[model samples]
Target: MPNGCDDQLPNRLARGGYSMRVRFQVQGLLLVLGILLSGIALAAKAPVLGEQLEYTLKFRGLVTGFVEMNIAKMTMAVEQEMGRVDENPAIVTDLHLTTEPYRKAEMIYPVRLHYRSWLDADKLHPLIAVKSLKTREEKEELLWFDHSQGEAYHYQSGELQAGSNSRPPKNLQGITALSDEQWENLLQAHQVSIGGIEALDYISFLHRLRSMPLKSGKQINFSTFNGKELNAYLVKVDQERLVRAGWNRPAFRVRMWEVDSESGRKGDDMVDLWLSDDNERLLLRFYAERAFGAMEGILETGRPTGGKDEGFSEATRSSLETYLGF
Candidate 1:
């Protein structure tokens, strides 16, 4: 529970178990999603369905786990329901983090975390988000956002015996209007306010960052709810670098920090990321510093489904090259 990123995972990571640390580290890569910005627009397009990426999580130079991200087409029913509010179809994003436990740690501890979000294709706002996590226990969480009605709902199933191994729920639950009891609980928990500041869930926030116009020295302000408290964050586009992910690729280095909503001061939870400097905006590398050792995420393989508008146009590429003095 350090820094209020998540309730369970961080506490488990703090135990200093190698396997748990690695799993926590892998999830940490995605935890950075809670620490990004909102607003401002560019000509960036949303990630196309079928885009797949795989990453290797390392702790102290040792491979400990793997993270996979994918974009899948949404069901027609779900798309139509969202279409009632907006004309755009919903994009479904999936994230899977599994431990590659070393030193026979798998037998001792096995961990897997799966997260999925349904986001507006045009607005990039989350319609629904769900995650199933497995460590020594299994738990599931679901968050539903009704922008039209200006209501948000959070449901935690506590613990389930067969939840983690099961697939994400196909049926959209909690789509109804917030009941009186639900409203009272949300107000007490302060997960998010209906008409308050725009707060995206973890997955939508990450995709929102991809849609932003990323230029070096740029800073953006945003807020997100981590299935717990709603916290503000700031992200700075630090610089561009040539990162080696299978090959040398131009990438933008971005750093994220938590900001106090009242004081507007920065917190200690920091995350660093390198995203490919192109329309695709692939995550090239990431590193997070923990109270114990640090965890690093390296792109092992990236396979885009070759959709339209994949990378920078020739003119844009040349312009960037001239600007960077390449």
Candidate 2:
């Protein structure tokens, strides 16, 4: 009996050593360490605010292992809030990309988001205009839209409509007709003009950080226009190279670490954004974990062809300036 018990003990010990639980523990530990190291590296490169920046944004979406959708080109401009500007405004956003099908059709489109600000009573009001230009058979269809008072206005050909409307009046025919809801949906799906308000918030946060004195580990909370709060940790501050997602636009380089609250469900929901070591005026890169996998955006800058400057008004500029301290 004693010999039988001793023999069984060796087999039990061998089985326990190779258990699935043990293997899982090892993998989980490694994942945690990797995440920690990433945070540490980011902290070491945090930048101070108020630095001039220029960079480009490149967008690539992978549909399969070999299929990719490459956007043409994207550009961004960043400047410190001059007086009372609260948000970092996007001076220009030019999108140039071509979509290639697996075997057939390919299409190219140009999208632009231009902004200009002036001065208001005690705040800096920003006016953003989005334009999309598509050419077909020697005919160019130019479309424009603006957002105001929780509604968007569409101006194309020679007609205008207000509110959550999409199509212009029947009387205003032959013009490119698009509703606010439709345009918004298209941009969101294609991830174009995705950074409009978010980019503004990023700039405002940078300005605030720039004005503050340097510290080892400083944390700040920022709320977006949509009421989402993001927490930023100031790990390191100084000058560094910052890269963003676009085609050929200039991007500001800065050092910063921000953790944004997850919008949807709970489990492992977070969006992490990092600026380069230099304190330019734009976001360098952002990483988020979605239900499927991890996704990221890198800024690429480029030059724009000659076009009209349909930007913000002087009165709106005054309002934004007063509000943001530009």
**How many residue pairs clash in all the candidates, one count each?**
0, 75
lDDT of 1 by residue, 1-326 (tens): 01112234334544666565555644554454323212222335576667776665544312221211121111111122332223547777777766543323333345577676788887788887666677777766667776766666666653333433332223353332334442222211223565766878867777788777877778988877676667788888865554332435557777888898899989887888787777777677776655443455666564233323324322233434544575
Candidate No. with top TM-score: 1
After superposing candidate 2 on the true structure, give the runs of residues whose Cα lies further than 4 Å from its correct spot. Answer: 1-62, 66-72, 78-216, 226-268, 279-282, 292-295, 299-326
Looking at candidate 2, what is the lDDT of residue 226? 16
Q: Candidate 1: minimum summed lDDT over ten consecutive residues — where? A: 69-78
Provide the overall lDDT of each model, using Cα atoms, as 2-decimal numbers: 0.56, 0.29
CA-only RMSD, every prediction: 11.9, 20.3
Per-model TM against the reference: 0.65, 0.33
Top model number, lDDT:
1
lDDT of 2 by residue, 214-243 (tens): 332434443322112223333333332232
**Candidate 2 backbone clash number:** 75
